[model samples]
Target: MDFKYVPTTCPYCGTGCSFNLVVVDGKVVGTAPFQRSPVNEGRVCPKGSYAHEFVNAPDRLKTPMIKKDGKFVEASWDEALDLVAEKFAQYKGEQSSVICCARASNEDNYALQKFGRCVMQTPNIDHCARLCHASTVAGLAQIFGSGAMTNSVSDLADTNCAFIIGSNNFEAHPLAGRRLMQAKKKGAKIIVCDPRRTPTAKQAHLHIQHYSGTDIALLNGMMQYIIQNGWENKDFIEKRTVGYEEFKKNVMQEKYSLENVSKITGVPVDDIKTACQWIHEAEKTTAVYTLGITQHTVGVDNVRSVGFLQMLTGNMGKPGTGVNPLRGQNNVQGACDMGALPNVFPGYQKVTDEAAVKKFEDAWGCKMPAKIGLTIPEMLDTFADEPEKLKCLYLMGENPIISDPDIAHVDKALKNIEFLVVQDIFLTETAEYADVVLPAVCYAEKDGTQTNTERRVQRWRKAQDGPGESKYDWQIIAELAAKMGMGDKFPWANASEVFDEMAALTPQYCGMNYERIEKEGLQWPCPTCDHPGTKVLHCETFAGMPDGKSVFAPIEHRPPAEQTDADYPFILTTGATIWHWPSGTMTRRSESLNRDCPTGWIEINEEDAAEMGIETGDIVTAYSRRGEVDVPARKTPDIKKGVMFMPFHFWECRANWITNTPYDPVSKTPEYKACAINVKKKEA
Candidate 1:
């Protein structure tokens, strides 16, 4: 196997396992973890191990295409770019909202926002993060100074206790989950707080079966117990944190009693007390969570509550103890760090500020809107609930039709989009109804840098010149800008120049350059050419950390968007499977991935299945107020009695269609957790 071993970051989970691209004879073959690298130690998962298969898949789109006469017809890049620019130009202003979704690199995401604010003349640009981690960011920002994770995955091993709530880390972040096990082996107690006994909880020294959406109450109850027993670290609180009295007065009061929290979270009172005792006893404790805590209406508050607990116990800043949110994607942390959110420019600087806006405006030679932008869910609302306000939408690398809340409403928004341009490697579910489709290059076919969960910015080398007639997304964006009369505005030779401009304009990437990351990857906030990028943040001080303080946003518990009533008895929640990416654009095409986990299946508790007269492998109809989907049921004990888990990766079983669209007023992320539904045996 004559191949070049180029080092790069894994494009799957945010764990950002560094690996080498097994390029055999200029054709990408497979991925191998960097053995010497401490993280993962040369280990890979079912998803990360076979990431190379999708690169050379025969089903990949190799040319620009326009939807004409009910079919995709090959067209020049000019045709698609003109349509996109003309439509965007028509609605170019503050009223025109643009919400970018899943997929796309940091560079592509930046171009999308610039196109929206400068050319489209609107501050209305958001990302799919609204659906995944908006609340995590928002909530973390409120409690801590920044929204990203406080500690790295390596810190998990050093902790004396790990409070993992609302996360199936074992299945989602396998390598990180193994680290948790290692922590357990080292006498670091593992606290698994979820509705089901997941693999992470199976070996857990302590597992608390908390009800969905009651995380705040459960965490508060633990804090209440800790406070009453006077188990908190007094020196750490006095020296490092603030707002202890307010937290005690607010959450430690009666509403968060053990009985009440037990009632809200569905955990036993004894279990709650035990968890509090364990956390109190441990010298250093870490809290790691995922979408299980972020996809709800009170997502941000749920996160804040966790931070409050961590602060109350002084389990932050030290190794093995901090608030660590295991991000869903490889670059989600980096994406946000690079200023992918609408309200904040790169490095999480506020876009509304004159100085910040001026920095970007001066760099682009264009004025940016002073106001904030609409979120993904908000854009969908404007289309269906509002009016013809949302007419044309150009999606770079997202599949909202299947991934967004209330899949039916998302579909309506797509139908209403007079001009829809979907740019991707393959025909995704969201691309089924597009005015034009631009053939975009995948990660393996391009050269660029992606920041991982650890905030490490690593290089991705071009293994092969793009497949067939395809072109890199960055080049496509430059072309589109030129055709749209911004040609003189966006004249770039390659992605490196584009990234350099982006890095220079954004404060976080101020000092980083290609040469700096030439050998080993560099973390952001490098600040100058002479500095090595920061490995761990808050080592000394936090970024504008809450007045060098923590804000305790105490919130009352709220029910999920849709509750279980007589008509809809069972509650259905949507999530991802290890085998698929967002909407299965690339996953379904991979032969090995398909062979291992081809179709999607609904997971139900054995008791619920027996009561509903459903057996394993029995196809059933799952319906809610919004829509209905038919999928085979695998009755397992992985879920709670009254709840079911479904992987929203397949189109045939549109889980989002049956999901509730009611969103958190603050973050606007839909409550995909607790929608009510009924399961019935399909007639043969």
Candidate 2:
């Protein structure tokens, strides 16, 4: 009986909490807290604590499986790989698409993009970010010159004021929640703006519940209030930013006045004034937001509005004074950094840029495509609308069937594709439609690096071997690349070799190497090995902007694409609770996690529940324009009247079944936060 504790980062949210996987005789038994990590100290979330159960579960895909006549049958790796290669060969350029997994490691994601562009010869490669925070990337990049968290995770502890909007951080990012609690202990004012009284809101000094899809209005109102009260930092604005005059001119318009804002959003004028005062009066204000701000039809506008507040208050380029987005997946930051998006290569180097394309082309020995590829939603839509356009789809570690918006449409797209290949640890919902399902190893069975919400890149070591025949995500991609006769371009011997190649290509990670970060991690924009990683960005100037300044984008509020009517007289929003992770891919497989949240339910306000004669735990059927789902009703004062909330985690009661598909024109993120629906007690 060999007992050892292998330290690794949690494969849950973007908190980047460290834990030690307890390995006995080459088998991972459980997780123990890693005490020396700077991010979480020695603590972890509930999902992280019980995350090990799925790794050794009996349901883990033990071997490759190929679907014939809609039935999956066990097949050897060669048979599966050969079939995938053959099918992918039929598709070229835009006809082929790949969905990289944000949860996978940097090496895995880097390998995937290379495979998609070089082997499959398509620029249509994207990940789950298209669903969650694509707006943050698009908007923040346009504003601050970089579309990532502007502050460090630990910097929250030093903040004098923390304004949390659109995020239930306590449930979504527990470590960040702890840091906020610590900051509170040190006399930081915490203000929360959400439609629901989230657990984080309960801890805030002010919890202002505004109407859904009114984030732009609320933020513009707050800025107007500050400007009217002479709270704008003129000196900082003049020196550190550009386009403030235009922003002020637009925001100071009577339409954005407190009364108008109050009418647009349901928040009282006094409460809006007070929220603005808190930020204005503070020495340093840090604003944190999550999917609540980004998963909207106007997601980019929502994000830019948040950035406008920070810039208006001169709350940037310092510790605890920037717009921070608490990312979702553990490696989501890394996935984006590794260039899983369609428009960019590794390090966000634009695909259309001749120099960037030439760099990759010179490195990989292939002339890359100049055209920007279709996004995940666009690719899926093509398969549905023009089935002949998309001939092959290769998915790695993503379950789009349950996670993507408009489940019926996604199902049709999957079925319409000529060839579908899914690579994952288990037979997920999306894998069900696959022509071939490749078995891939989980994080514990892989050695690679993951970047957290703060852009801190840390090493996650392999604790034990994966289940039978399962390979690391990078290994699987490399195997397919080799079979496709692109082995020379992807000659990585191992994950580290893949990382080395990626680091050489990505400017942000150029300073980092596996050996340098063996013990401690380093944040990106570390351009050289001699230079220590940057803890805070924009200290002097924004990285990619032409001038050393930021911009304020004045945006107007637009109603959600779908609004409640007499037919569907309620607003339905989708989210995740602390008990389960996204789509419940790994967390749902855990016995302990399942025990805590055995099923899915809809949260309705007490008033709505009372009016409808509905009680807690009563099964209810919810209907929308697209589809319907049955779930248990959970009455709570935390929710608002005429509103319903459901977590899109359980497959048995997929909340996305009834969710609308309206997306942001700029960021292309589906408005998972708001849609029209009607509900009633299920006939039991």
Candidate 3:
């Protein structure tokens, strides 16, 4: 058997760990560690190790399928493209929107947005970022003048102390966890604050189990304590930031008292002081968070609190000293950077900006829409309206049916839409409802660039050919654009040409090209070819603020939309495990991963399990006002009492069935972390 090793980036999480696909006789057989990778350095998580298995899974969609009289029939690319264009032409502006994928490459997403704006002529374009770090992008951009991770992944090694909250980094971002482990090896303090005692928590210098949805209070309390103890960075605050006085007066002094904050957050006053002390004592501290911070009614405020703590500690503009939001999907950051959000064009350029609009219009030779579009939730919600406002939806690599909050509502809305087009490698749950399903290539079949959590744009080389009739997401989109009468506008010869177009428009990626990224990827804000990519942002000044200073917003804590009552007596939180991923569109198809994880299980605190007559391995039914799901109970003390945790990986017992839709006002991110639910033992 002829054997070859192909180096590629992981398609699972935002950590962007690199590995080699082990090919035998022209077939992908397994994965080998890419030891030379700057991100992972040979270490890979369980998912990355088994990533190759899903690329050639038996269930992968091999050809386009169009639904005729409620039955899916295999069709040629021309037939499918003609039908899609015909249906899409019936809708206009707000009525037609495209939901791009977080899993696709940067080139794929950039093309998706370009097609949506120029060909479809709709400002309504968004992605899964609406479900995840939309709050991070919104809140951080307003406060820090930028929205992405402020430091590179490797910078975690230089941290004096790491204050990790809201995320189970070891599970969700394993490569980043490796860097934190390196920091610990060098004696850097690690503090974990979450409602659950995650694997990362167990490794921390301090683990403070705070109440769900009270992150703002907890952070403000710490800031108050630090300021009270004279640990506030007076010099840094005065020189580099704005609105400190308003924040200090309104939040720390007026609203939050150590006693009041402790009472609201359900964390003891002493533990809050201890967390503050660690931050106070450390010279270079990094604040890392994930969905737990963003999936709340106060998500924007929650993110701002993390920013407040870091800025108060003089942590910006340096290595190992900035607030880091570990993104979920591998290319979610890249998707956002490529302008998947409705309100902005690529590189966070506003749709309303006359100059930016004129620039893009000149480049594309088409007038751009000035009005911003609807977010994902808003797009889905529009379908529920009488006479249906949204006529068509073009979804790429996203499974909104399983991933969106309130699946029942999403189901009804999807059914009401006039036409739905889904493009993905697998026959996902969302694809089951599609009027037309376009077969798309998996990462193994595509050569493209993906920006990781660190804003490092790394190239994942094509390892093998895709199965019959399947095309790369970008190719399918470009072909669709061509059919939709935009053939002359999209003249991309290859993925490199697409990247070049994206880099030319997006200032953050101006310096990036396939050539520079081939050897070692560059972190963005690269700007020019002569300029090396930026490692740590805001080294000299914050990005694009009116006064070149970071702003500290005085945010107050808000309770979750739905609180535990006599009917729904438990607080439910959802997340992904190390063995499984969100929606499980890709991971569930993996033989090894499925063998390891098998199915979904709800993590109930031992005390709650006993109270409900539930035991480990016992089937339990968890229901909220929205819907109910039954999964085997996993009795553990890892989670806080009265709080139930489940991973939204398996569709058999979708955790989103019970997740609430109440969103943050500023960011529109659903309050997935603190929904109220009730649980009961299922009779055998």
Query: Candidate 2: which stretches are off by over 4 Å?
Result: none
Clashing pairs in 2: none
For model 1, what is the alpha-carbon lDDT of residue 104? 60
Report how far residue 542 has shifted in candidate 3, in Å: 0.8
lDDT on C-alpha atoms for all candidate structures = 0.78, 0.90, 0.90
TM-score of 2: 0.99
Off by more than 4 A, model 1: 95-97
The sequence of per-residue lDDT tens digits that candidate 1 reaches over residues 449-489 is 77766666777777776787888877787788887787665
Q: Which ten contiguous residues of candidate 1 have the minimum total lDDT?
A: 94-103
TM-score of 3: 0.99
Candidate 3: which stretches are off by over 4 Å? Answer: none
By TM-score rank, best first, the candidates go 2, 3, 1
lDDT of 3 by residue, 470-492 (tens): 99889888888889888878888
Please provide TM-scores, in order, for all candidate models, with all chains considered together. Answer: 0.96, 0.99, 0.99
Ten contiguous residues minimizing lDDT sum, candidate 3: 380-389
